[model samples]
Target: MENSDVVIGVIFLSQTIFGFLGNSFLVYHYLMLYFVGCKLKFTDWILQHLIVANFLTLLCKGIPHTVSAFGLKDFLDDIGCKLIFYLHRIGRGVSISSTCFLSVFQAITISPKSSRWTQLKVKSPSYIASCVYMSWVLSFIVNIAFPMYMTARWYNRNITRLRVFEFCSSVQHDKTSDIVNAVFISIPDVLLVVLMLWSSGYMVCILYRHKQRMKHIHRSNFSFKSSAEFRATKIILLLVSTFVFFYTISCILQINMSLTHNPNSLWVNMASIVAACFPAVSPFLVISRSLCSACAGNRIS
Candidate 1:
């Protein structure tokens, strides 16, 4: 391998290992919590599912790229390519949907008791579970056409190529199928972005109002409820903001790759790296929050 390739391989391997470990830690932590009979909050359930999705995403996207970067060519066969790409897309979709659900659920949870949104809090757990199930079903159904189109070079002898890369390629779809696929992929992403923004904005407003109200109260008489809400809102905002940043960059890189018709370009590697950033970083944020919360709880006791 060239020096540049080696460098890329090292970076990719490091990211894959870090993301895998972080996500694994999150999954293990939550599973232990469950087995120990600790009652999981609604958001905790969403978080556990998100961790699994992110871990799968890292594995599916990162492993192949890392292998290729290390000079291992054609590491995956046609079926393997299709399966990895399909599962990666599903995992990405689930992560987006789960994060959106988490934000909306928290928004509802922190709403004023008199507000209509707050009334849904009682049913939030059921709503979250239903949303998670629907997201998985929709992702699986929509991406079924993926394996039909995807193949490694060995399997492409009889097919008209849509786009060719060193790693994998897909057959060109007809106009209708292409449009349908585009819409299918775009809808969930667009909806999640909208929901995340609205929920984040609403939470920000709520936090601002609470801060204003607190200015009139004595410091010693501050409300623990307000503090907890503030912490939750801050964490959610941070997570949403970071996700949007990385996701937008990744999307831009992907668009560049598609439009340029060069799947082997450095942009592809960059896009994978950018996409992996969120999964690698998000788990640490959750761990930090959990540790802080635990410390705070212990102090209070």
Candidate 2:
């Protein structure tokens, strides 16, 4: 058990290091844009919020756990467990908000003259601040008591073998409290999924409309505006699609574990890794926009 955990720990440790370096470069680059007061023309102020949210997601999930893995220390005392889990939950919530907001922003940006949101489009930036604020507040409200529901247990004392981080036990509270926790957790998940699905469908619709329009127009070449927007849309779609895919699977595994009672160490660890991978991989995937742009137009077809 120790041997297997050690091997996996080493691998995740590497992921932790690489994720940090990449996100660090991204954070620095975006900060330069913010500091220089660069007019973010093609995009809007929301990109700043997205970048910050991604950075937090990566930092919270990747850094401390890496340290814990390398030290071969669970370090999940009561306070420690609560703090780590709470912060990571916040990061996770913020990520969902940022991604959903990105989708809506893109949809608004590309809305046609006949669209209902056209008036909202006129003052898009004005509406964006409020939406992002609401996203944060909504996420915070839903997840505020998450830490209270989780308890840290010494792995050997509670189970056959030790695992990374202290094991977490859940509510022995009243049925009402348990129901509340489940509903609170589930509400955001459902809402985010709906937001992402709607945004994705909306983006696909716009892309198809653009394609149909292109067929009639002079295909002289790609205009930079059209090219940039299309590529950005593709990248955002890919990120959100990946998020939804893995997120759905992880949620299923969690539910399965909940219902079935016995989740082996292997299954438990694998589920943890699967859930963890989405947030870690998301930043790099988003940043890869630059590399793929040269071929994005070709791929878009």
Candidate 3:
């Protein structure tokens, strides 16, 4: 156990514990909202699924990296490696898709009545559950090849062309196969990220126009600052920015890893750490928004 590895393990442990607790709190809060007969919005359903996916992502990726970082050997068998990697990939895909959906939904929700998105804004809520389910199904279908390529790390054999992880090793396919697989795996992610960015831009334009319109009517900066619209916009941008920043870093690392025959363990650990950041941080952001909304509702009532 090198000192650096130990430090990485400690970091992973902390992220896993904090992310689990934060997501668990969110899960409990939503369950209570349902049980208390509170009317949940369509976006609430998407958020519920997103939190679950985040927990899944943290658990599958974090625990293994932590165990491996501490110099644990043979912790996972072949079946375990395949199952964990497959599930982690699915969780990641769902997180990406759900975030895109949420952003697009919100953009539509806030669009002016005469805008082109008005029809979608009216009809979008009803399909939230179906959209979430389809994302899971598509993710599963797309990543089904992962388990076939993954196996437990072989200690005795000297594998020359394998990309070894902490507990698992992926077989390096031939060039044509590798290109095809990469394309299939990355297409959905690329599409989702594009949609998310587009919707985020749309939201920003709407917010800017809204602020300009409000300035003439209110004539008070404090009133605009205190408004729910401003608060919600701020939260959305923060969430989207956090997701994109960490996600982009992880993607770059992943690309670098793919281009190398033997990926560096340090690079792997760094990628995992960045990958876990959004999931770990996002729940606290949502919880803050929830608390704020609750306070505002109380004052209103």
Candidate 4:
């Protein structure tokens, strides 16, 4: 393999390993908490599902890309291509949906009891469960065309114009079909982005109000629950902002690639790396936040 290929392989492999392990740790930790009879909070339930989605995304997307980068041409057959891409799409959808739900849930949770959002607080668990189920179903339905449109291809060093990965290529679709698929894939993402932005904004307003109120209260009268909620909201906000930043960059690069018909360009690779980085880094962020919160609680006590 070329030196560039080696470098790409190394980067892909590192991302895959780190992301897989981090997400796996989260899943294991949460499952253990459940088995030990600790009650899982609504946020924990959302996180557990999010970790699973991230883990699957890293595995399904990263492994194939890594193998291809390492010069394993035609490693995946047509069926393998379909399955991997389908799962990756599903995982991506679930990740977006779950994050949106988490943000909205927290927004409602922290809203004033007299606010209109308070009603959602009581039904939040049921809504979250239903949302999760619908996310899976929607993702599956949207990606069902993947297998029918994908085919495995052997890599040819002499061919310079083919921009797809060495292992698989998507069959060209009719213009109408292309438009329909694009719309279908984009609707959920657009809706999720809108929801995330709205929820985050609402939460920020709530936090600001709470902080103003806190200024009037004596330090000795501060509530630990409020402090914890503030910290958790901040973390979730950071997470959502990070996701939006990365997802936006990735989407722009992908759009550029599609327009230029150069999916093998370095920009495409960079997009993939940025997309993978969120899942890889998120688990560590959660773990660190949890540790810091625990330490703070102990110190306060």
Query: Per-model C-alpha lDDT, please?
Result: 0.81, 0.66, 0.83, 0.79
Q: Ten residues in a row with the worst lDDT in model 1?
A: 292-301
- Identify the candidate with maximal TM-score: 3
lDDT of 4 at 166: 51
Please write out the lDDT profile of model 1 over residues 1-301, one tens digit for every residue. 7998889889989998988888888778766665655665667778877887898789887888899888886878988989988999888888888888888888988899988886688888788789889999988987787778788867778535557765887787666776687787788798888999899899899988888898899998987866776787788788889899998998888767755544664777898888888888898888878722332342211
lDDT of candidate 3 over 109-154, digit per residue (tens): 7788999887887678867657779999998999998888888897
List, residue by residue over 101-191, the lDDT tens digit for candidate 2: 7787778877787889888787876676787888778767777787775555652255333223324544355547656777878887688
Evaluated against the true structure, the overall lDDT of model 3 is: 0.83
Error of 4 at 247 (Å): 0.7
RMSD of each: 2.8, 5.4, 2.9, 3.7
Q: Once superposed on the true structure, which residue ranges of model 2 sit more than 4 Å away at CA?
A: 35-37, 41-44, 63-73, 154-168, 171-179, 260-262, 291-301
Q: For every model shown, what is its TM-score relative to the native structure?
A: 0.91, 0.82, 0.92, 0.91
Query: Where is model 4 poorest over a 10-residue stretch in terms of lDDT?
Result: 292-301
Q: What's the true lDDT of residue 97 in model 1?
A: 89
- What are the per-residue Cα lDDT tens digits for candidate 4 across 127-193? 8889988998998998887667666665323334344655676666555776787787898899999
The candidate that achieves the highest lDDT relative to the unseen native structure: 3
List candidate 1 stretches off by more than 4 Å: 158-160, 174-180, 291-301
Better of 1 and 4 by lDDT: 1
lDDT of 2 at 182: 72
